[model samples]
Target: MTMSFGRFDLNLLRVFNAVMEERSVLRASQRICVSPTAVSHALARLRELLGDELFIRTSTGMQPTARSLAMAPLIREAWKSLEAAIDPPRFEPYKSNKRFTIAVSDFVTMVMVPDLLAQLRRDAPLVDLVIRPDSWIDLAEQMDLGQIDAAVGVFSEVPARFGSSSLFAYDDVLIASSSRRFGKLSLETFSHLSIAVVSLHGQHEGVVNGFVAERGLMRRSEMFDRAAFERTFTGSKRSPRVALSLPHFLALPSLLEGTDLTAIVPRPLAKLLVRSHPLSLYELPYQTGLEKVSILWPAWNAGKAPQDWLRAILIRAAEPLSANLFDFVRPARYASPTSQQEVAASA
Candidate 1:
């Protein structure tokens, strides 16, 4: 079972990779903390063993030969596989000082960041988190390019190459003023009434509009889709009656206060808003169904220690978000103050 290469030093591959990455023997030696002569000798031996030029000297720098270029990727992949196989599959939360970047929607960030930071502080205290607004088209690409470690939100479309896990589900509820008229909210009432919209991309039309369209509410849909028809509705004159269109869900409470603006917010956020502010929650005429939120990572990151740590923390944080909205297992017996605690802890 003991097979070995005859007079071939596998360490040369490491030198080759370093030089290829650095494009200069001197730089490669500096990177690997070795002498320039040692790097040159390793490259010479490698060129002879492979029977190819491997690298050609140019005015700009050392350019990789066709043969070296073809072999470099395979060599790197092999080294990665070998290292992964030898390492234990455990991420040390307290010891790691790694910086993790995550792409998330503004709504999810508003709801989950506090608790996430709290948990991170208690556990991996030194680790830093960088959050950026992730868009649908570029989410997977960002993960693929190593731009971000993970993403979280209501993902309408995700590439099959990426890995995703559903953290929790919550219902979207309508929040209106306490004095607003109810009992079968009519299209006239729906159309005439001003509304506050929260969108990550400053969109006027969203889930609520889609739900209204499903019910064949034409005039109401048009009102909801005002952004699309803005040109036709106000061709030459500016419409002054339209209320504020904000980006963050947290801003809705202040926008709605002393005004009759309505907004459809996630149930957890809606409850949190009502509890903290002078807002009221209303039962909508139709249900927009439960919104499922999930954390996504690159497929290449599966079984990775860093990915595992992030996943476990997120899943733990999502427990509170799922408790009140669904008939699922409660994180604890009493859901009110604790539920709010859970929400705030992850804030």
Candidate 2:
């Protein structure tokens, strides 16, 4: 029972992984293109060698034991490392039917996804994309477990094990219904009006002074520049009240139309919304620092061809928008009604 590494079979790991993923002996056999009898024999050999029942048959399905649960992640990571070492480093985007999963915010989906999809369709017709919300509490864990390939958003802190690249930078701007014919948004007037904000966690407060630390990941749960808002109203008696806290931007336009509610959002997203909706963009009464939107991936995937290819496409897609971001953030007083349309067209 005390077998050395030299005598241990590596193929058994493949069978184990298949069973672990499928959670059923018959399904696992089908996944590996092996007969159920061979899968059963392999499992038996592994169980005997390890002195543990890795999985137990139950009414639901093949349930993994405590030992299996403990070993699964390590075994899977080891197999991935082995495969990466043995396999040739190449990715043919045009011919291969590969699927990539990305975690993104709704703002990024609105501004960037269309261009990304257009380029992807032209360059890699067979490649597929799966988009997940960035608000998931387990986003970092999912990335570590290989369930998510990459994420796009503003990360306050990225662990050293991950690699990041800035796609673009933006600042905050205020938006209101154009019908209001609002003049300059002085600090006093801005503080008096009701405000709407896109809060991923539905938090009422707009002041996110620092990152929300959760499970080894540092993320921004609030969408707007809350710290700047707090600084602008440090000692004011009538501070701005967040009248609405919505989860996504889809309902923001309808909610703001013909209403006194104004929202503080990223400059780029504000420009996009103003072009289509009856919204008017305004410069924040107080200056806010710029925030960079970035894409993050596992550090180990740095030179992998698939990751490199996807990164290249993403950078190319964002280049035009990045170049014109300054136009979107210009002072609202100096901007003309048609400026939003022109900038949006160029982007």
Give the whole-model CA lDDT for all candidates, comma-separated: 0.64, 0.81
Query: What's the C-alpha lDDT at position 67 in model 1?
Result: 89
User: Least lDDT summed over 10 consecutive residues: which range in candidate 2?
Assistant: 331-340
lDDT of 2 by residue, 181-217 (tens): 5566677877888899887866424325544555566
Task: Supply the TM-score for candidate 1.
Answer: 0.61
My TM-score estimates for the predictions, one after another, are 0.61, 0.84
Give the Cα error of residue 109 in candidate 1, in Å.
Answer: 1.5
Q: Which regions of candidate 1 fall more than 4 Å away from where they truly are?
A: 1-79, 86-90, 177-188, 202-245, 327-347
RMSD of each: 10.3, 3.7
| lDDT by residue (tens digit), candidate 1, 13-128 | 88988887678888989988999999899988877777888999888778988888678756755655677888867678899898898977656676688789999999999999
Clash list (residue pairs), candidate 2: none
Q: Which candidate tops lDDT? A: 2
